[model samples]
Target: MPYVPPPDLATLSLPEIAALVAARKLPPVEQWQPQAVSDSLMVIKADGRWFHDGGEIRRPAMVRTFASLLWRDQAGQHWLVTPFEKQAIAVEDAAFIATDVSEQDGALAFRLNTDEIVLAGPDNPLTARGDAETPALYLLVRHGVEARINRSTWLQLVELAGDDLCLTSQGARFSLVPSA
Candidate 1:
């Protein structure tokens, strides 16, 4: 069967987005305790480019598949996990990039570079880093992995934010401006 992308966020209500989020199945990387740990020689750049052994992984589907297997440990190390082994991967800034964003039923929805849709909520809250002068925003994708909000998406979020430069979704509030 051909791949069918999720419906546009603009047409989906908050409940529908939640249902979509719940219906998606991801690899059980967290449950795997692979004794074999090695380097995958994979790098995810801050700009969201994926490379392997110095060659760019240009296929979106391949990237998405790899991304589904990603797991970030408590020490902030990234790894591609499987039931048999775990391979480390370098992440320059964030594991994924938020390429687009939209608002629906008072909730914010984000589209990642891998074409995955994420909703900002208690389980996937938004965070800010750096100083107020150069703030960087991120959204928790899954299993401790985050997606850096790109410049264009950040601008769109800012436009949707209140005068206090804060955005709220699913009862969780985030300040876009970093603290001093």
Candidate 2:
């Protein structure tokens, strides 16, 4: 997708921008072959803060806009891909953070830092690293991209964990720990 700034960005509300972002179709980055590989100073920290040139990107709109253009190539490399250009960026961890969560209609829904909503299920399954007491939780967001579930959200999910270490969302039960 091309990075076209909205003409009235100053006037457009966050929800409006989010709607536009959600409505746009991303380009087939896998098919794009760019000869120039430029180094981007942008880095997504482990806590999901985006930094550029050693400074935090304070604008949520800018961060969310850039996030819409993010892509991961088959070679396991991350890039900010556009129709006309591609730049490599650094990711200390997952590119996004699930900052809030709620249970609705028997399913758990998460609100990402980018202001996008994702439901936990087979398509966006939850996974954990480390042990039961101190697990690092993650939720798949998009094409091979994931968001780290923040501590609060993880705690909420933990409360839902059953005796078998399984979580039920939207009537589907998912095992948080491997069965013996």
Candidate 3:
């Protein structure tokens, strides 16, 4: 018999399929952007058990979820999860926007707008939406992503505080204090 694709496959595109398997289909961690349509990176196992759906692995997650796995978090905060290494980035977490990695002197270099970097602090304070105060856009790491920062991907990590916030994140790590 000829193999048939699932009915929903008709509504998807190759890029869409790739996004579900990896990349921007899911929202970044620590940011409260609107939810996406699909949030899954399928992993097909070697065993024949998971022929179509893949093998023993992380189940399909809803794209709208903040926890990366589930949309709702018990902590009452939205967070993003990475399947690559089972890592999670809090909704309040932030990173700078970086261009595609380019090779420099045989090394990979990352670049970002000085203004495009900011922390997603607890709430909107001095800056407005699309404002410089927004948490630095995070890098959507691939499931199998691993690199040594060949060219030292420069980043200015900013800490998120309340409406009146303080920032940090280069060589120092600090804890977040929640609002009561």
Candidate 4:
């Protein structure tokens, strides 16, 4: 069946967005304990582009499949794992990009580059990094993997934030900018 992207987040309620997030069944990469570690020669650029060797991975399906298999180790290394083997992949910034965001009820919903929906809350909290002059926002995806909020999405989040520059979702509060 052809892939049908989820409807606009503005039209979906919090329950509906949560349902969309729950529907995506990602691979259990953490369960795979493959000892064979090798380099995958793949690099995820800061702009959310995936490149293998020297060529860009153009197929969206292929990228999504690989993304499903991604796992980040405790050492902050990115890997593509299977039951048989695990391969290291370089990441310039983050594994995924939060291409869009929406406010629903009292929660924040983010749409990743892989078309995955992530609802910000306690389990998947928002974090701010970088220096005070240049703040970067990240959303915990799964198993230590994070999606960096892109420029446009960051702007949207800023607009959604309160005058104190804080955004609250699911009882969790996050600062839009890094505190000095």
Candidate 5:
């Protein structure tokens, strides 16, 4: 489907817009089973920067709006999905990045590149990949969707690491490193 900006998008505050996005009931793309695929020129870089036609999408709001429509199918393909159409896009790594993090009420809250907030714990767990020297951390953002932990956020999380190599949030303990 062709993209349409909300009529009040320009007038709404960030929180209001976030609420509006949360309230949306997107079509079940996972169940759509589309047999046709059309490639788009958009690419989400490994560093969580988005580009279209080789130009960086510099506007944060525009990036967030596009991200709000992102979907990943069972085949592991990513798309910018709308109710009427789905456009395939390339993702070098995760679709979004956790650019900022904070702890509140015993939980770690992450602010994604798209301006979406996620609380990390059991439901939205944190995990690290790669070796200790170059570990890559990630956080679950939504249904089968994850955001790469940016360098600064990774450092912040590292600071919370316990002697046991575990991080506790919301009364849940997550191991920062896999057990030997």
Candidate 6:
């Protein structure tokens, strides 16, 4: 079997979330309704440096990562749009996809729109520009673990920790820590 992501998130409280997930009160694909003080379509991290492995100096880059966000809202499904502006940001996104290259042809591979992609820039994120602290909800895609990225050329990723899929965006790694 392969990895599958959930499709729903219910409520946004940390402890309650943990409990519901642990107790299996929610389904694998439950909708998490979280209230954000800002926007949820985008999340940008502070500026950082992307360096070469051999002590070489590349241009510094920032971080832009998002998860379970809706960029486009259509009749039922929405089209995602990424806001990454730097080549470096694209590079990192591509790398993440590259690592998860799927040999199942196109059957298992996937592409991320804005929900799973982020870009970095020189300036800091303003309130209106949108940051990770924005209001957003989670919709667990209750399908078999599938490759969330494709092509591996320019990708955006937010690898979160999964304690039953408790996704936290405001963190060093923005990882989804298991909600035990």
> Which candidate gets the maximum TM-score versus the true structure?
4
Better of 1 and 2 by TM-score: 1
> Cα deviation in Å at residue 43, candidate 5?
0.3
Largest lDDT belongs to which candidate?
4
Q: Could you tell me how far off, in angstroms, the CA of residue 30 lies in candidate 5 after the best superposition?
A: 6.4
lDDT of 1 by residue, 90-143 (tens): 999999999888898768999898879999988899999999889999999987
Better of 3 and 6 by TM-score: 6
Global lDDT scores for all candidate models: 0.92, 0.75, 0.28, 0.93, 0.75, 0.24
Q: Candidate 3 — worst ten consecutive residues by lDDT sum?
A: 115-124
Model 3 quality (TM-score): 0.17
User: For model 2, what is the error of residue 37's alpha carbon versus the real structure, in angstroms, after optimal superposition?
Assistant: 2.3
- Give residue 66's error in model 3 in angstroms: 9.1
Model 6 / residue 33 / CA error / Å: 2.7
Superposed by TM-score, candidate 6 places the C-alpha of residue 9 at a distance from the truth, in angstroms, of: 28
TM-score of every model?
A: 0.95, 0.76, 0.17, 0.96, 0.76, 0.19
Q: Kindly provide the TM-score of model 2 when superposed on the true structure, using C-alpha atoms.
A: 0.76
lDDT of 5 by residue, 81-111 (tens): 7665678889999998988776654667777
Q: List clash counts for every candidate, in order.
A: 0, 0, 14, 0, 2, 28
User: Where in model 1 is the C-alpha error above 4 Å?
Assistant: none
130: Cα error in model 2, Å: 2.0
Cα lDDT tens digits for candidate 3, 28-147: 433444334342333212121111233332322221132233232455332234433232232222222243233222222222221111112222111212334332223323222211
The clash tally of candidate 4 reads: 0
Better of 4 and 5 by TM-score: 4
